[model samples]
Target: MILKTILSGKHYQFKSVKDVMAKANEEKSGDTLAGIAAHNMQERVAAKVVLSQLTLNDVYEHPAVDYDHDEVTRMIIDDLDPLVFRQIKGWTFEQLREWLLATTTTNDIIHYLSQGLTSEMIAGVCKLMTNLDLITAAKKIINEKTANTTIGRPGTFSSRLQPNHPTDNLRGIMASTMEGLSMGIGDAVIGLNPVNDTVSGVTAILNTFNEFVTRWQVPTQTCVLAHVTTQMQAIEDGAPAGLIFQSIAGSQKANTAFGIDQHLIAQANQLGKQALQNKGQNVMYFETGQGSELSSDANFGADQVTMEARCYGFARHFDPFIVNTVVGFIGPEYLYDAKQVTRAGLEDHFMGKLSGLAMGCDVCYTNHMKADQNDIENLALLLANAGCTYIMGVPQADDVMLNYQSTGFQETATIRELLNLHPIPEFETWMEKIGISQNGRLTSKAGDASIFMEKESM
Candidate 1:
């Protein structure tokens, strides 16, 4: 494959496919910190020029991590439909990009083409897309998965209500949960990032969530973002978990740092299926982020975009109920500022949708980063327009436990109204019954958490 190109009378030479992938990416602090990003704009364009001409087969042959050495690479390659791959193997990245944007490419067509794509090819095409290109192409694809209720249906927007407290206080957590549900959020899930990751602590929280959801007849799933083993143990001890949750990485070594592997994830899925029988078919929820592999020293010298795309490729093997990137939570070291964070959020969402997963974004930032609530809100709106399946809904967009800012419950409610979107059909019906919403808009009673308390008294 050609890794050399000329741009505006300047010559640029990339050392490898990996090098081309890194340099071609739009500006990211992680890439620069990794010492792989282009030194100047001219070289960045030059890298893109060279990458645009590379064939799908060229990328396929040079997996970011060798198949022999990495299970993620193997899973990405082995799961591809051989028949579909043959038809598109010879197409150049430029050709693939144009075809995706062509009027002839319908959602069904793009979905079919996705069966043949490897993560490397997906990442390669992603680097060549402009910001609007990312939005336009992603908007055409709808990937839906069901755990307790369905998500990603057309005209639907959803939120994962995150009732996280600095301490795992059940009353405080429930207060937040009631408020979030009253605002017409939590249709996607009511998951928590536990302050305590122990089996007992996780089980207690899951049991409380299960009881509340059951009593209120909330049509959503509940999970505690504990380690996979802790969750498994909790489930084994009879905790009612609708979906098993884990944080995945793009490389085997990074996954190891997260204390997971394909075998472990597969085992968790099996346990989750048996536990959640008759509830839903898709039983796994995965979280990923750009720069995670780099953070763990496991990127194999690949760019964060390529590494992040590999995460989707790995995640698809399990047919996860939801897969979202915790964009910006990794802090300024990887994303730097609002512009970089916004770009990564868009790229990750687009790449995840193209990989055929129910995708969401955390739409968040750190206090130290050069960003504010406005930047997170802007990215949230963009992703919503791009057909994102769900986003996190923390109270006032602040997670005291996780120590970051994300999309708030009120923000989600407003976005649903502004975009003319509704929650999952069943959950929306439940909201109507409770007088929290009517005709897809929040009612006067929507903001009152005491509604549930009144019901409890009755």
Candidate 2:
């Protein structure tokens, strides 16, 4: 008797095939043991009965044995966990396959799988599915998980104020923000990628935005994209800590460079909860991308996709309000072209949503990439279909500060119009009140410039 062991995070050992069969039967019996026994018997008898009749190639190319639909169904029913079989017993294989392909909610698939399908079994079946079928199934899971575990208020579309500028130039920042606001954007939070990382620099940017809010009376929050430590200091110094922004990577060393770890993130979250006046508002904003671990030389031998998922896991611990994956921003070294960009965007969104993060996509690309505006547009639409929480609303799809072309105000309008999505409830009200957006239709007035300039002197 040969001992066979299956080791996972822990270990399970069986003294012999009979022991394994007995254990399986004890847990829940079906064809599992009987099928194995029969297969073993057939293998042993193959040499004696068919050895003289067939060549090596024929044996290798053909199945060991053929089973009709009834036989196959019987074998599956026997091996399946009793609960799973019961759930699926009434449906034929074709019907079951079709139902899985057509199902739009992940909860249904998860419910079925939980009935008794193992991960290995699921993966094996997935190998036979087309890419579209696989993506549809993944989207269902993401949708269900996102619906249940989202951080911020649920049931509304959100957008961020990514007003980036060189030198933290207030004029450029304000102009870009006004452009977005003119088109009725900036619902998530008005966040800035500061040129300076100092406490004073961050404080100045936050103060400028605070003054803007006071003067304009826009329903929004503010953030200066600095390290959490600096932002925390600004908060201590009485700056409005609307949202704490940080860039995160998969590995500890990479995160350390950003002055963050799980402990620091928790501390910052608590600080944000105390500092910000809004009750029940999510205050953490995290930025992650596909190649950040590899670019930081901290991948630790994992592939980029796995590393990206790990970053999402790290961000989820903080119950963040927003997690944006800067897809395609890292250039072609990581993700080569349009296809790579689209897949990475979908995968990142899917993984983040599954892990219960409020997932958004910066449907963007650098100038040096092999991709173009059409690629960005295609990716944006796909993400919208997948129910992405938000997207970067840069001016004319260009960010001078980051030197990348991302989704613009026009794309935002197009997406909303096409999908009939509205902004978050509060911002939607503000837009409707101000006549910028009415009844889900966005309109711009000629005096929009005067509104900002009239208050500029204040």
Candidate 3:
């Protein structure tokens, strides 16, 4: 009972704290919402969190004054440890790159052979980790750029129109670099196009699979993606033909391919069996960050980072995404994203990562407005990491195809008809390898996933 109450209290307190922070961010009061951290949790955690990637400029900690001080400094430092450590703006990708550059740059290679730290001493390598130089370099770049352009978003890597947008490109390079780190198994990714709330954007992408295989002169593989249990049954009740799967909320097992949101499933089961009674094959896809609204006005769909970080667990129950909106194009009207012509969302930032994972999807697929070149790069990393072997993006007339060949996992399909017009050389290279006919298709052979089940046997 104590534990439950503690958890409940934490949730309640956290919500209240977040609300205060949000208010401060909009600049409605004398205290910035981030400063509201001072009100919610420990001073240290509050300090660090408020100054995260989303609000880097908003934090005003004077290290020289605070750290060099006496008792007060120690008190402040002690509290901020946990919160500041969770970096919001520059995240895992940049941090990992900084670590690599620090330890093994071209200049450092010679030193390694001579007297640099060795694996034996590496046990406590955190002691050697320092990014003062990296920080300087990043700052130097920031300084060189014009003053008006936006850099990164307060909450994500999404860039604003600041003239100092050098950080915008860094996100792509870092994303591509980090692609090598992925273990490449048990992926749960989503593909979304600007919905304008029309489910057809999603349906169109789904229908493309058949055309792809037919053009390739291979048999088509079908899959079902649904959220509601009854929706699953209703679609299946008609006894649909093809690969049908359900994407539930809470229960997710990659091999099982039937886990879904516990809450939604309960709603369906409680509503009666007849709620949806279709029988074919379907998988449930649930959103981790979404609350009651499956569709948001932001039109910017899911959380890409949260998806990649927990892909294994999510696929065990649900694919990471579904049909939704993208940011950037967010406005009152559900008009298409003019910037990303083909579809609406999917690219760098957290959203891009999910799209990247979608490139490797079997049970999930993606569609978005026409994306920019940079967005393409970010999403590509996710696809490559997911072991996608083929692509469906491009036009039937194009001489080349875009393909992401996963060594042993799943394959991805792209939307070729929309992609062919946008000329990206790398994108083209992918096309040539994959062979894009509006109807081309591919799949990933399931690598051994029995290891995840070892605990069950025990």
Candidate 4:
């Protein structure tokens, strides 16, 4: 509906609601690669004009993927609150954006509003928002969830201490973990991207992290990022897991490509809830990224932004402890450069928060992307200001195992100081007790991994 707009004596037309959504999206290489992007900037603006006038009912009527054919679409549609949808179905996208930014609209209001929204509605409103609008609105919402420790509390920034070793060496992994913990990182999680995805290998790493955590009384979670099935098996075998990790996409087909389905993920959710020792109300950790659907041939003619928004829609169903978008890890073919990557990072964080999920970001880039560490660092700072739940803390901003650059332990510590933010309250207490940090600032003992060695030889 309302897919035609005339701007500057030029006629622009979109074939469908999905077409309008794709063209209205900001410039991203991924949408272009999918052959769905606007041909020119003028057309892009015209598409936004058309999108602004479209009603919520119009978008809701046209799910990006057919409801019957796709379980993701079905879930998004079926789960919508009929009462809330009726209250706002007549509202235009422009109105939605304005209401979201209105001073009278509080965080609780948006959380209530989210129940009625489908992924298309979220992506449509996002297209009409500026970067500052995303930041301003997202800052109003803080979705805190607990998994042993709470995240997303205002004035507290968190990081996942990713001590990944290429060979899954327990010694090297623990060394990186100790260094990160020493600098007051790992409050969010001390997670690893294991080179070995085997159940036994993952279990061993989980045990190692448990031992270290138990020894030091770290008030954080430990996760081993592996396949959901692998993690489920490990959990079933009594492995020490704080959070169950999985990479999810926006579409059923893409998730199938990842060897996952809603049923399987639901099973893992149930398993983690029952098996893990510190299983909090939220026991799942999900990672998503733009272009993943396209890469797997599962976008179904929707734009990457819409697909990415759908990811949050799916993740929220599980009450995840944290759901992060690996923004730039897909490479230049998708995000292209720092600007696009930054935009995507902000958008994903905003969308996740709007969906009522505790959102984090792996503010990261690969070597081939037209981005560097500085660009990622800037994005991380912006995200932190947006009240992002957490970010990854790899060693020196480089992931030797994942082959990407992310925020480092130093960056997490520095951001906390710059923003006058502290880690989780329980974690900060532990940090102070061990002399790694003092009164929200890093102590002289910070950054020394050998401090952990004072107890026993590893």
Candidate 5:
């Protein structure tokens, strides 16, 4: 029998998990692809099978699957981890919902799910929950997990200096870096999205960052955001590769457009790891967004949210130092307005955290988008409360090189102060030691300005 589901206004048909696996393999064959494909397929299959067996009364009255008591118990005992099974083996859906809501950390939830808590079980519990309950549960999970977890290096809140210039001029790059540093930013990593993707161009950018870091003795690392191949070449050419950067999308066509396939991505991860053995820093930086698959005309009928999740699964393979969802930068075709953009930001953060990624949100929009600073402000606050890892620190929320608006250094400060969040531990310590910041507040000293200006003159 064929089961049909509507996603992203498109109809998808599946005979079984086998059919889905076959299609996934035909498109892109890999362990990560197969794993995500199986999980999605099983979730859909379980939803149909479990929901069909339940009656309205059984759903509302007992808040449990409408199967025979013995059979349901047997399934739970057989599938779930012994600890989790003991907790919910004989419990109704109401009980399960209570337990899940009481669960604070995503790590524990992930462990349970990994131990075989099926998606059907989750769906059943969700059916009995109110929106408030779901939201509350989500908040608890994000807050607990993100508060304790550290990525790249240990820190509470981290941010990056994305100083890009269209012309790839050293002066322009130095100006942006100095501006960000003056504002006490760049804790996560100082990275540049190069206008030039070739080996020579990328090498120059990396060498420039290395020189700056060495001259000023900055605590943070730097990255020249180019294709993996170009980055590898720069490393071979004696340039510092502080981080390996790439843009990733969900579908094969989209990945190819970014000059990546699963094989290349794996190879890049391996290369980054090998290089970082001597440097002793986290090796990979990845950027992703919703609507990219559709933007590339390769979504393959999945909704933007699901496609984004699949990209996370793809990114997780590398255990990246940072995975940023460029939420509103994709434009209005997919996410039309502020509400959609805000929701996507929160959803991406939640999804990334659940998947064990060090997630950051680029609270940003474009000139053509139906969004503004207010939209970015609201989303940034929400992400902060959600325990987001980092944000993009551009100048005045405007990326001159990329032609997009994002959270600037001042905005990051506003959120940090509002939430009492600090930068990553090492960089924060450096900031304090250098007198650039004191008591978690930026000094914006006159001497620093003179220093940068003096360097610029030379």
Candidate 6:
């Protein structure tokens, strides 16, 4: 895999709110960074850790150990640092050299690489080692971004901790996710009345415009889905006439408790469809695996679990009249029949973590990844290299966008006001295929849904 994922510009690509705003027309929502950072936090972390371990074990290594960061931080990274050998908790330059010489590891004293080192710490280290200029440059970039940044609040996306999430990336994206969702949190309930029922027959479907996310024990951001497949329809159909709305609403509420955020609505409009299709290449994929572990949807129960196992994509390309469900309702067991499937040997506890590049969040990390998160990073690198865009089943991924409430999809805003979000260029046509209206604000007849979802395969 490539060492880093570079855009056409080669440097890490980032666009502020203003950048996208400048390009948008009256009908267009100028911001859509979701296309860029759409990958899950866990997947990214998994990729990062895997890459770091691969690099440290093979490509590069510090000649000595160092103790400069927090006490826990120092211990966690001591074996790999190169400048300070023994003394920690603030050591002078003289103390640094003497300790390095005393250590048996190496006298060559090459590079010092550590995790969670703030730009300030890097600057101090830079002052001591003139040869390590590259580190200084990287640190400078970090310093500029965090110059006056505030921290994430409790129950916020950024505040939730990943054992080894890159601090810089986490801080930046969490803020964005938290803010976006905070702005407009609304779900449309699409219920239809059928001609035959004594009571008004209806089914509720949920939909939302922001990049949908969910948690899978650990904070991971991968591919999450708002799907309505044969299985979902059966549930909706089986329920009482008017009760379908309550059922859908209850399902969503339940999902929220399990770290899943689902919205009920008609399909996207014309432009919105294309955007979702373009960005969500693996729209229907989820984290699959054998046995109930940390990744088990069993924690969510049968009704929800069935939703993940049986639901297909909402688009007509898969099935028509489909409504998207929340994230938690799906889990890992749907992915594998064998108990052997796992990520980093964590026993597939994170059953939701697996599959797809840009379109997944719940890939199974199992017992193995938990044992060594570097394994997770390596995974991230592979997915990043593959050009895949998302991951859904990890906890951090969902929390990164939701709990923080920094910036995300809000129901009240128009296409322009919502930052980094846009309706698909041809969303309405896609909705029409299901007999739904253009804006997703109107509902179609129940018989129409039965006709639209006539196909069972995705």
Q: Which numbered prediction scores highest in lDDT against the true structure?
A: 1
Clashing pairs in 5: none
Give the backbone clash total of model 3: 96
Residues 1-458 of candidate 4: C-alpha lDDT, one tens digit per residue = 66898998988878999999999999999999999999999999999999999999999999888888898888899889999999999999999999999999998889899899998899999999999999999999979898898899999999989999999999999989988888888998888998988999999999999988988888999999999999998889889999999999889999999999999989989988888777367899999999999999999999999999999888988998999999999999999999999999999999999999999999999999888888988999999999898999889888998888898888888898999998999999988888877877888889988889886522
- How accurate locally, in lDDT, is each candidate? 0.92, 0.62, 0.24, 0.91, 0.64, 0.23
3 or 5, which is superior by lDDT? 5
Per residue, candidate 2 scores C-alpha lDDT tens digits across 343-407 of 77877776676555668889988887778999899988887776778888887788888899898
lDDT tens per residue, model 1, 133-157: 9998999998888888888999999
TM-score of every candidate relative to the true structure: 0.99, 0.71, 0.29, 0.98, 0.73, 0.21
Off by over 4 Å in 2: 1-155, 455-458
- The TM-score obtained by model 2 is 0.71
> How well does candidate 3 score on lDDT at residue 86?
44
Cα RMSD (Å) between model 2 and the true structure? 13.9
Backbone clash count, each prediction separately: 0, 2, 96, 0, 0, 116
Candidate 1: residue 299 lDDT (0-100): 97
lDDT of 6 by residue, 34-135 (tens): 122213333333323222222122211211112342221232233223444322324432333233234342312222222222212321222222222222
- Give the TM-score comparing model 6 with the true structure, all chains together: 0.21
lDDT order of candidates, best first?
A: 1, 4, 5, 2, 3, 6
C-alpha RMSD for every candidate: 1.0, 13.9, 19.6, 1.3, 9.8, 23.6
TM-score of 3: 0.29
lDDT of 3 by residue, 379-448 (tens): 3333333222222221111111112111222112222222322112222233234333122222231122
